[model samples]
Target chain A: MQPQTAPSPQFSLRPPMEAREKFNRLTTWVIVAALLIWSWRGSEMNPMTLFRDAGNIGTLLGDFFPPNFMDWRLYVKEMLVTLQVAIWGTVLAVICAVPLGILSAENMVPWYINQPVRRLMDAARAINEMVFAMLFVVAVGLGPFAGVLALWVHTTGTLAKLFSEAVEAIEVSPVEGVRSTGASYVEEVVYGVLPQVFPLWISYSLYRFEANVRSATVVGMVGAGGIGMVLWELIRSFDFQRTCAVMAIIVLVVTLFDLISQKLRKMVI
Target chain B: MIHVTNLNKSFSGVKALSDINLHIERGEMVALIGSSGSGKSTLMRHICGLTAGDRESGQIMVNGCLIQEQGRINRDIRELRTHIGVIFQQFNLVGRLSVARNVCLGALSRTPFLKGLFGNFAKEDLELTCKALERVGIADKAWQRTSTLSGGQQQRAAIARALVQRAEVMLADEPIASLDPESARVVMSTLQELNRTDGITVVVTLHQVDYAIQYCPRTVALKKGHIVYDGPTANLTRAMLKTLYGSESDDLFGRKEEAPTIVQGAAA
Candidate 1:
């Protein structure tokens, strides 16, 4: 071992930054500041509006005071239907995502397969759940089933992307180990790939389920059937009290499902 | 028995292995010794059909079955692999699965498709896994997650996997490269025992010449993608090694005295 030495006078506490690096850092900050300003103008952001329209907002909110629970039974029933839609949607998505995710992973499949499958997932994810619900409502003629289909398609896209990433990040040696046993391709995936990615997949599925419940509520606004339809009607008819009551129900149900799914996710991971 | 004729492998334009020919008889314990980047691991991988040779080079036959020929693996390579077990240096058992389940995976090719998909091995296969683990002295760790075990234990589990495979040939690629001296002795002795008792043909690659001399009866040496020596281990000498490996002979002749001693007859 080399002998220990005291600090030399030539050594500095911090290294000096090069001119090129300093210039690049300054340029990045300038670009980011310019982009933020441009977006602020494009988005028409106005913090002053809240103070300017305070009276109007107060009057509108006051109209919702003392929420009416006369339609509480209907609100609860439709909320239950929303939960059902989320359940079926999440279950179907989880099933389809397993295969689709494997197909889309670059390490799992060849480029020819992964490229096309990834494009398909991109198409599914590009459109929002509301748009999918609108299209499905036209095809299926407005029902909870349509909402289920919409959430299923969109959630499958999201979950497949997440699942493929997990699969891609796995240690390749375990899969190679399985292959060395003379196991077939599918068997290798089952024994090697799935075991490594199982926990992350479960966590992603639970997270998607929570997000799907929120989407399910809004799908009803497109006549796909849930609490959102009643809420939409009450807003259109200016029944603020009933609308407030319905929003509270939606909040309570979403929170309850989110907590339950969080617990499940924690248990698995 | 295993045979390789004029096998060549190249990554891009640079040759990793070149025009190699070798044959191992049944129940032989042979060691492949080379310095790093000497194509020892690549040759071992080629023998098992895990890696393909150059398109125009040669063919490999393991247990009278064609593993690969001219860069094309046999269509029935998976079935052929069932009879030829391979162990890697990293002990690549699935980390999340139980040790027993990882070992039972050796029976996948024989199990029904649906059964294998669900990881439902036959009762006899499960029993074989138990026996294999017992033979390797890790039966008590059967139900534990594989990642929870020590490196030596994990490596033994891999050996158990090969036992369950009922392989006629066992190829180990630097099985002890990552192990400490004591664990390395245990692993080498285990391979020696299997070759002795079960009559399994064993081929192991090693960078340390001391271990090769102590455990293997036959030694094959590679240098710069070419076979430098293939002979009985007893004929190898310090002068011969210096001539073959030059300055790198020091690495080949590792410090043997620093390695731990084995208890008499414990490995047997």
Candidate 2:
């Protein structure tokens, strides 16, 4: 240019944010900070108490040292039972979740059907697994079967929610391509939707299995069955040494499963 | 044969297509040409009963079977649609499935529900799938996951799927819109070859008039939802297109000079 000119108006490196957007963003941060502060007080959080009670915790921890392994055989046996309960529970939940998940997916069914099915799933999820274990113990008269039933219902609710979300996020064009072939609805689902969601479904199911294994050990606290009942009895009688031994077993088993399932999930996904 | 009458469509109060009537005989390759927002794809979707027209709109019939009327698709549309194959701008193949399985899915209508559900096709259906894949020139790709294929290859796979359906009429809605020039030519020629040899009724919507002039014997031009021209491709002159599309006609010619050479080369 003959004269030094200002930069052209046509190009902008970045568009300036509107005042309203800036205001909204600031408001959002303020609300989040306010909520966090309010919850901190409401929940009675006191970080100073940790240092104040260090001696009491040390004495309590000392009681758990040199864990007693006298009932190692019983502990191992019950741990196997816990694994079995988790296996059956996860298997049944996966089966039930398949149909329930499809029924609850907004893209798969109408609002009337999905709404009611979602509400039912919500009710199932709203109750804790421990609560369900107590109810099932009463109904089934206490055993591994009661633990299995509790995990099945609770896991079905969780897996169905996960499965439906995967279904909803799928691209609709593939399903339309299937529909154009004059494939029936069930055939379209089996061929189109199922293929797209299969990997994610398997991944979610394996993840739920990991969670269920952790839960299975605790269901026995309500007399549902397995190592948790033994754990509960030891804790109640202040048998801290044996309690430590049982806790160690539970931790080992859960960690091993988590690792195996993570590898499997990675392969599938 | 496909027949559409009084096909009116409106999206929320704005007219997309209005008062249209068309009849396409079997074994004819017709090109539907229009600029974007000209309702060509919308009209094609209506023909196959993929979309419902206005409640006051008239009937659409495919092969003398009622497809849709007064905004309601026929109760037996699933059976009726078996003979109508539709190709989209996006290939729309299931990415995780093998190409062979995707083609076999075309026979799902004839297979038993439970068998199809379990992905167990009949022996004849499998043979048909193989033959269809071979015909489309991608039989080697049959074992590959569909998502691994290139754009042109995936489109060919979609055509193979349609072939396995034994479709009597193929409706391609902007089938080549998203393709490169080479892929576009390949897909158009494949469609042309099918029309000539199989005697299948073909209706393809195209944006570039060069392709229409080269591939289709007859042309139907739509502007603002009205069929401004319906005649032999030889008769649609530049002036006629200019009058119909006004300043936007340049888009139809596909940037002027290139269109003439392609059309002239096809004519020669």
Estimate every model's Cα lDDT from 0 to 1: 0.93, 0.93
The segments of candidate 2 whose C-alpha lies over 4 angstroms from its true place after superposition are A1-42, A46-48, B255-268
DockQ of each: 0.71, 0.72
Model 2: per-residue Cα lDDT over B176-252, one tens digit each: 99999899899999899999999989999999898999999999999989888898998888888888899888898
Per-model TM values vs. the true structure: 0.94, 0.93
Docking class of 2: medium
* Tens-digit lDDT string for candidate 1 (A145-244): 9999999999999999999999999998999889988899999999999999999999999999999999999999999999888888999999999999
Most DockQ-accurate candidate: 2
In terms of lDDT, model 2 sits at 0.93
| lDDT tens per residue, model 2, A1-269 | 23333456575776678999999999999999999999999999999989999998898899999999999999999999999999999999999999999999999999999999999999888898999999999999888999999999999999999999999999999998999999999988988899999999999999999999999999999998999999999999999999999999999999999999999999999
Best by TM-score: 1
Candidate 1, residues B152-241, lDDT tens digits: the string is 889999999999999989999999999988888888999999999999999999999899889999999999899999999999997899
Clashing pairs in 1: none
